[model samples]
Target: MSICKIYFSLFLVSSFLTFLLSIYFLILDFSLIIELNLLEFNSSSLVMSILFDWISLLFMSFVLFISSMVIFYSEEYMAGDIYLSRFILLVVMFVFSMMLLIISPNLISILLGWDGLGLVSYCLVIYYQNAKSFNAGMLTALSNRIGDVALLMCIAWMMNYGSWNYIYYLEFMKFDWIMGLISYLVVLAALTKSAQIPFSAWLPAAMAAPTPVSALVHSSTLVTAGVYLLIRFNFSFSENLMILLLFISSLTMFMSGLGANFEFDLKKIIALSTLSQLGLMLSILSLGDYYLAFFHLLIHALFKALLFMCAGSIIHNLGNCQDIRFMGGLINQMPLTCSFFNICNFSLCGVPFFSGFYSKDLIVEVMSMGILNVYIYLVFYLSIGLTVCYSFRLSYYTMTGDFNYLGLNSLSEYSFIMLKGMGGLILFVIFSGSLLMWLVFPVPFFVCLPFFLKLMALLMVSLGIWLGYCMAKLKLNYNLSSLDYLTLSSFLGSMWNLPIISGLGVNYYPIYSGEIYTKIFDQGWTEYYGGQNLGKNLSKFSKFLQLLSNNHLKVYFMLMVGWIFFLVLNIY
Candidate 1:
């Protein structure tokens, strides 16, 4: 077997073993902490530690499982690449880094894993060696670097306690004034990793990576690292900070949903959806329901991974065409692929009985019951509705509408290895919600609300479907290409110009400043003063000295006689 295959098999086996161990821990309600002193000073020590509990174990299992399937999928998807082994090695290292983050209780150790994620993800993003990939990789790395710096600041702030293990200090630090800075930094770090709001540009741009990397990094493990961090540090947040987090997260959710509705590229649309779901997770976490946030995070990982896989299968067969405008009636040609796609879409919409329903529905219901601001309530519900809106819109454009492709396309499930990889997650997409709910929540959530509020989610879903169908039908029937219509279309279609705002808006000034600096300091002033002018002056002085030293003995004698004459004059 090839090394990739060997690693894939090994990962699969490890996933199963980890899942079993997770179940064992859940049954026993067990936890373990292991610590070793690495180095000691007078009053401080560098220590490495691991915290093994239900949460970490369960999360680790899911990470391993998803990674194994992604590796299996990539075997076919990345088949012809010369650096396939290197790619596989990078993925394995990514998993190992994630495991380190999952198990570590100390902030110092977490930095190791955290930096590893950022570095590895950058490598993965630029794997294709294209200009687009290079730009996306830089965006990915630099955005995450913000969080890395924030975490470093957090570690420095944490030194006030003389220990780097945050778990031990969360309760005591909850009311500490110093914790305000730490909490802010923590939330900032989480926001960056989760791609919330201002940090969102990189998430969609990162679609330049291979599909399997998208499935593993963007969908499941890497993005959720922020949500996981907040879950761990939930106690350290004050009420005001939580509210601020809620506001940002809700806005992020609504913004992504709005952007997804306007998007046409297949992978970018899904990437936007992932952003929206991340917003949802963060909002729930901000609401202080850490368990529900974690629940939805895991469930989202499953369906989103499947969703990306289905999209990958379609793109693979369509000769890399990702524009949904050029796609239609794929369901007729690729029945199984469309079926998986639709199921994953509906799951994302939180249709009843699907994996998302168990977590998302509960999150909405709980939000409804809470005494939240009216705007928060509206944003949450409206974002939920928009999820269905864009989902149905996507389905309409890609699956049921008239055939839109210009040329003959082979939309079939010929990639059996990819299908097999997706098949592994399909079952979980259908049932993981219930399975996780049963395992994680021993006590059921108690939700009491008015009938209309209870039906609000369903009502929005129905409305979204109707609107999507109407919009698709209208496009087919009429020429809606007036200037005004086109303007509005562009606005909504471009994610409210978030790509411009976050991508170009945030970058333009710095890039402009860099240009100025390069011209003035690097190429202009520094060259003249530091390099060219200094060299010219030194060369002129050397020439003058050489002229005075002329290689003849007569020249030397003349200089000595001149010096003696000047000395005699001075003496006289």
Candidate 2:
């Protein structure tokens, strides 16, 4: 009937069917690969390959499920917009591109999907058409282009093997330095795609898009593409490369975690949390357990999608206001939405028995069981603590204090459609942790350590809560004591303002050179010689014509005589 209903039904049915199929594949330990010979040439058979395994099927199911919810959610979320159908089309394309990526093991096929993601995400990010959206979209597209180039180079390099399907050579890449270069390239692509330290600016800036797009892109599709690729290429990484990834992931985690504490924009705060969690996923993957990485990935996706949806509801009800400082006492008005928000925040903090707890606890124990040096150990635990810190800080600001924003009486949870969309996910976010753990990892990891070591996770979480309370504490009496530590709140001590420092530094030189070239070549040379000079000559000729043709018959006769003289000369 309606546009949202059509897409919702389609994606919902697909999600259900694929989820069952994924279970089947998982239980039977089965994978189906189909190859179509596109061209048969001399010593090479270029083929299109599609691989159906539990990972692809399950990931597709998740994408479909989230899409269904988002589309259904948009029934209300985007009802006022005139371009609703166009937005729906963009979202559909995004989900399908993600599915295409999930199924393809061939580098060429993966490129089709990979490039689709980059292009569609750019369009979606710029959908609002404001300067902020335009800038964010450009940043997103250009940053991802680096990864696209790396993937393209990877395809060219794989041509030496006479096949684009690197799935067959996963183990071989570990042994050969030449193929190992491909792994390095793939890692480079993943790092850029996943928004690792240097490339991470685009992730938060992309919040300029609609909240629904943020939910889909940041949660399960665009950002996860990189981590999923790494998981697929897990066996291919050399030990040295893995260690390098470990350090980079650690830095990314620490950076984002610290950044979130300073962020006031609610969507940006959640986006930063997504980046932090992604760093956690990559860090675990680098430590040689791709399963834990995927586990955390799925777990994070569930709660995060719901988290973003809840955030969207809050922003929508607040008349597009996203600043948390102006929002308070939401629990008194929009109790249901606040409940959902707090639950998601708790899950994010990896509170015991929640969905994030199962996977995060496992990962933490796995890291603890391993012999790691001091810096890595502290970074991992501290980042985890920071995760809790930001989440607590967000909740304390939004739900605990008096309503300080303009629309105090206007706040209410009349968004049944949006709540219904979030309703589809809350159960999964709460319970999927244990279910997935039992299903995927039957043999639990034995985390044997001393009593103090075992209590470290609890300690970090407690410290995070205390720090969050301190940051969010009200300074009603002009607390001079708190002002003394303003450095940590505003300047170098906080995220080191790194989203600016790290993200901007890489683009500074190239952007500066382009500006200089625009001024010198474009404005100075091209403007004067190409368009400006042409316009000047045309203006002079037009002035002569205007001078001659001041509604005078004599001028007209003179022009006619001149034309006749020119014609006579040409004829002669």
Best by lDDT: 2
Q: Kindly report which residue pairs in candidate 1 clash with one another.
A: none
Q: Write the per-residue lDDT of candidate 2 for residues 1-572, one digit (tens) a residue.
A: 98899999999999999989999999999999998888998997777899999989988888899889988998899989999999999999998889889999999889998999999999999988999899888888988999999999999889888788899998965698768899999999999889997788788889999989999998899999999999999898999999999999989999889878877889989999998999999999999899999989998999999999999999998889998888888899898888889888989999999999999878888899894788989998999899998899899999987987894357878889999999999999999899989878767777898899888888999999998888778422222124243555554223445445545566788899999999987788888998889999999999988877776798778889999999999999
lDDT of each: 0.87, 0.88
Q: TM-scores across all candidates?
A: 0.90, 0.87
Lowest lDDT 10-mer window, candidate 2?
A: 475-484
As a whole number from 0 to 100, the lDDT of residue 38 in candidate 2 is 88
**Residue 469, model 2: Cα distance from true site in angstroms:** 0.6
Model 1 clash number: 0
lDDT accuracy of residue 107 in candidate 2: 92
